[model samples]
Target: MFRIFVIAVLPLFFVFSSEIFTFLSGALCPSCNCESAKPLHRIPRPQLRPEFLALENGTDARLGCEDVGYKMHVFSREPLVVYFENFVSAREREHLLDISEKIYTPSTITHNGGQTSDRNTKVRDSEVALVPRTEGVRCIERRAREVQGWREEVWIERLRVQRYNPGGHYSHHFDWSSGRGGWGRVSSFMVWVHGEELEGGGTEFPRLELRGDKKKWCKFIECEDNLDGEDSKDKGVETAEDKKGAVFKVIPGNAVYWENFRSDGTGRGYNETWHAGLPVKKGVKVGLNIWSYGRID
Candidate 1:
């Protein structure tokens, strides 16, 4: 009986050995959620609001009119930077501008413990609108969350819309906060809404470079500036960035998304993620900031 069983099992083992090994390895191996396991690349995402959940009703759903057909292109993989075209619709841009105008405050910067004007033009010189989660805002939040493919422990910060006049700008800075702000930002999503004839006001990441995708990148960034771009003021004076990083131009309805932390699961800010909002040389510019965070350490 034993000889017969061995003879029968020998052919079966040869035929399904690979599948058996794969199944056994997966079933007996250490679980991915173990403490020693590597952290996931994606962040935790929030669930959708009820309105978005009613999509089964099709065209009658509240989201029917808000449907967008945006496309995403990867610019960097190490720090995970991506560009989104047509992320915000024209009607949504108008709505954001209207709502922001009603609630914006002159954003201030600190200098030697004293307050500076929103028009300082030194660090961040722009009016800020900490928008409440309205219908439009919620729709955006839902879209942002969906785009990221996150659905874990959810924490999305308030949407901040910064209004920049001709001379306005946000200087070099990192979005991640190490101290009082808690576990720091997980990632950042920024969108542009420029008025007619808007110039300059591009988001510059000095240390980040673009070496490939030449043709596709032109639509999202200024291709003429080499690896690092230099934008001149209205008077032909060069801006601070001489030759280090790349600049993403103010393309209305377009967005820039990047991970804030290093990929090691240390939850530390990646230095390459540092960026600045270059000064606005001409017309008005409004930018939206959507920051996401994981739970406290």
Candidate 2:
């Protein structure tokens, strides 16, 4: 009996010792014997410095961000589309506008066999300006980086501010046409910097299917673009949201984020993400894009 008891206790002791060794080594999870995981997909964190300056024009902003009330409203699960409220602070928006002066030229398009076209074309029309990195600019970058959940091989592109005057538009297009050397755009964030007094410039993803409270969603989406009684706000209603698509309203301080690639770990451009910047028909609208990439390596 004593020998049997010793044998049973020995196995238990060895198992407990192995777990303690694994924990102390800090190389693998003690319980699962797998690699320790790092945190990702964090919330945005804005720069709170009392004074921030723009690197491009030396324009300064006098404000601090103790906290950001930016809220994410999910619109899709497969391709991961989200709408953010209060994504940009008022002071940062002003700084972006100040730096854009004299910097914008007639926008052009590059498609099909290296050909280029001016903003008057039927597909796309908007003046684009690259945002120089400043403290204020970095504030936005930090937020995007946090929200995007950085990886070792992935990096964010420099911000590009786009100005769409009345009649400006961009037809359906993919942000990641193809991966270059195994790298490609994986996510996109479109931030509305300044667009008050503007109308008819909504971002639309014609392939997405959206459904929610009509009254709440209309404030953020172009709900009136296409709606029928079949797609009622009431529950248990047989709806046809797939045909209606998703159109985001042009709201100041708000933004839209979505995955540009397939979610199946392929890093391929998602066909369902084909989106368009609807024509601006009434007033000028200024927005910014934060694009991130993924690598196959």
Candidate 3:
């Protein structure tokens, strides 16, 4: 009876073992996420109010609209700890501009593809905008305090203002530095004090590489100079006020924002952002930039 039972069970055991072996040996498999790669459809531009971009629906929603692309506001879980205010009185605006002008003092200048510290660049004087945070003005410090969980010695790290002149452009470039000892910035921000209607000069973010795609590049086109050899000053991204400009008028009085984060939680922040400033074809284009460094000590 025992021999007969063994004979009956052996066939069933062998059959089960074969099935398990096949699965373990990769005889059957499922698809992966990397099979195909394509660029994501552009996000729709968000509606603009007097100064601030409407934050209804979602913070990830688009804000400014342009011919090439739209501007996005990126914050953590809550609404932006950082804010853009064009509501300041004329007197207050002048005061802030004055403070920036007073703190600027050029320590170095780099031509061509040469480089300099953001600290050094912040010191230069330009007719457009000023970026200063030395003994007196610590805007970056004040801003860092506003962000939750960002308690640390507020280091201006590096501050700079771009005095975009007619025909002058920073060209297509990424804000992240490639130096041996880089800024190691965890977050970065910029505020455009004045708006420009100058054609041929608008910010653009090219489609990003997703899935299995390998190419990732963005370009800023300084719209071709006008027939007069000056900026046609076509409207820059539309704002909520319904005002626009041509040439070098800064009437739009708005701000733009972007972060270097990917959708799937892979590469986020500085590593993935590629940007540039289009050539200024008419009047001066001024902008203030703030770079935040991760704690070093």
Top model number, lDDT: 1
lDDT, residue 37, candidate 1: 38
Worst 10 residues of 2 by lDDT: 48-57
> What is the lDDT for 67 in model 2?
51
Which should have the higher TM-score, number 1 or number 3?
1
Q: Write the per-residue lDDT of candidate 3 for residues 51-75, one digit (tens) a residue.
A: 2111123322232212212233222
Model 3: residues with Cα > 4 Å off, grouped in runs: 1-92, 100-136, 139-141, 148-155, 178-183, 196-200, 208-253, 260-272, 295-297
Full-model lDDT, candidate 2: 0.70
Clashes of each: 1, 0, 12
Better candidate number, 1 or 2, judged by lDDT:
1
TM-score of each: 0.68, 0.69, 0.43
lDDT of 1 by residue, 145-263 (tens): 78777545445667889998989988898776541222446689989876568888889898886756565576777654332344344445533333246789898899999987664
Worst 10 residues of 3 by lDDT: 212-221
* Cα lDDT of model 2 by residue, 1-297, tens digit: 999999999988787986766566544421122343221332233232222222223332332443567998887877788889998888888988888766887667755412354445677788888767767777786677678775555566777889999998888888876554345666789999878888888898887777666557777886434345443545444333433687788998899998765533333456668889999989999999887755533
Model 3, residue 295: displacement in angstroms?
A: 4.7
True-vs-predicted CA distance for residue 54, candidate 2, Å: 14
